[model samples]
Target: MTPVILTVFALTYLGMILGGLPFLKLDRTGVALLGAIALVATEAVSEQAALAAIHAPTLILLFSFMVVSAQLRLGGFYDWAARRLGALPVRPLVLLGALIAVAASLSAVFSNDIVCLAMAPVLADLCIARRLDPVPFLLALACAANLGSAATLIGNPQNMLIGETLHLSFPGYLAQAALPVVLGLLVTWGLIGLLTWGRWELPAGVPAPSVHSDERGPNTAGHPEPGRPLNRWQSAKGLVVAALLFAAFLFVPWPRDLMALAGAGLLLTSRRLHSRRMLGLVDWELLVLFMGLFIINGALQQTGLPAQAVAGLAAAGVDLQAPAPLFAASFLLSNLVSNVPAVMLLLPLASAHPQGATLLALSSTLAGNLFIVGSIANIIVVQAAERRGIRISWRRHARVGVPVTVATLGIAAVSLWLGVGAP
Candidate 1:
């Protein structure tokens, strides 16, 4: 049974690294789900244990926010926001700054992946319309979304996991994360601006990419119609609910998951937006992925191999309990297998350190800017641009990603070392 669980876990994570199995249609989500099923079927983990392994609070909170983000999309807020930013009558560099600001702010409240998914295509269209190259702005959108999501526990799935699992206070984590996240966003803006100087316009003899309305993909329920008026009322409703939720998380002593669930309930009661429509936009696959990974990780933990491995590393002078080793591990593993899985593997060690949650959340997220595969936000932005006939090769992404990651990680390391946000 140990070997079975180990084999299943190893294969599942390998799928995560490769993005799928060889010659199979199973993606990371599919692979995770399959691994959990195998464990249960082989009696390595009982059905009850598998069910118990899923973190209900994290799933509830994640699902609730998806509904909230859905409401905003349905209200045309994202489209309106993108258009407003693109239409700003300022120098291209200044416009890039505005984009970084907006993307970061929205991502801090909404999930980073949701912000990118909702905004990227619209941004690509607007940039083509304005005859400005969309590459830098798209990169900024991805980088800012990743950086900004680190500012709060609820900003992204991995941060939410870290906060909830470690029982870190919302405001406490915010205090620790705000400085590096803010500084990282600014650094991202400066790097992009410097790299794109004098090359902000579309290349000579290259026609603007065509925009097809239907290419927005399956999650298009709330996408804005070209001539449709912004639904200010619906947008306001979503915003108010989000604001109240944020306040509750900050001030109220109630469970954050319940408060968020209540917020989702409020948004679901909208008269104009059908419940089906709102629910349709929720990332059910992500929820399933979380559940699957939780079960797989839980089964692995039961074998005690991870504990032995950590102890072995500690014996070798590579102590993950220390800030420096943990920070380095988080950054490396995040890029290797992506952030969520990396965080899952490292979370058990978080309790050993004073600022483990903050360190994990910040380092894993900031490391995502190192490559396109490093974060879902980056992938969303790139795929969106590709659909519009704009190609952003890995080399092009590396030009910005490599420097932004190095600078932001440096800031985070220094801040953590100086006890800037230490509790």
Candidate 2:
């Protein structure tokens, strides 16, 4: 049973890294779902255990926020934001700064991937219309979203998981993360501005790429209709709800999940927007992916192999419970398997150390900018750009991503070590 469980775990993670098994139609989500099914069929994990393994708080919180994000999207808040940012009568570098600031601030409270998804297409079109190269702005959108999300536990999925499981002080974590995140965002802006210096437009006589839009792909961005005006009332409603939720998460003793769920319910009971439309905007695939990974990871933990591996590593002086080792490992594994799975794998180790949660959150989130596939936020921005015939190749992305990642991680490590005195 142990070997069988290990096999299932290995295969599932392999799928996660490869985005699916070769010669099969499975994507990461599909592969994850199938892995859970295999474990159940083999009886390595009982139904009762499986049910218990699912973390209700995390899922509820995640689902509730998706509804909230959907409301903002449908309300035209994100579109309005992009237009307003692009319309500023400022130089390209200043406009780039504004883009980074807006993206990072929004992502601190909302879903980073959704923020990128909503902003990318509109930004691409805006750049094309203005005769400005959209590549740097698009990259800034992805990079800032990932960086800003590190500011708070609720900023990204992995951060939420860490916060909920560890029961770390929300305000405390914010204090620890705020410095690194702010610095990181600035670093991202500087790198992009420097790299694209004086090359902010396409060559003469070359027309801007035609922007594509359809309802086919996941949350596709179709061509914008003329004068499809902003719904101020709806936008205000979402903003107020989101602001209140942020306050509650920081100050109130109430469970964050319940507060978020209440917020979602308020938005759902709207008089104009249909519940179906709002729900349709939800990323159901992401929800399924989380649940599947939870089940598979839970089953593997039951087999005790993880504990054995930890002991073996500790024997070689690679103790994960220490902040320095965990910090380095989190950065590496996050770039390797992406952040969520990396966090899940190292979470148990972080649980025993005082600074483990802080180290995990900062390192994992910041490390995502190291490569395009290091975070879902990056993937969302890249895919959204590609849809509009604006290509951001891996080489192009790494030029900005690599230096920004290294600088931010160093800043975070030093800040954490100085503040927490972790070795």
The residue-by-residue lDDT of candidate 2 on 1-423, one tens digit each, is 888888989998998889899999999889888988888888988888878888888888898889988888888888889889988999999999999999999999997998998888888878888899888999999889999999998899999899988887888899888887888888888888999999998545545555444411222255343222468999899999999999998899899999999999999998899999999998888788888888899998887888998899999988878888899899999988889989988999998777789889989999999999999989988897776667789999999999989989998988887884332
Worst 10 residues of 1 by lDDT: 219-228
lDDT (CA) for every model shown?
A: 0.91, 0.86
| Cα lDDT tens digits for candidate 1, 157-218 | 99999887878899989898899989988889999999999999987655565656543333
Q: Give per-residue lDDT, candidate 2, residue 44.
A: 89
- Residue 370, model 1, lDDT: 94
Q: Which model scores highest in lDDT?
A: 1
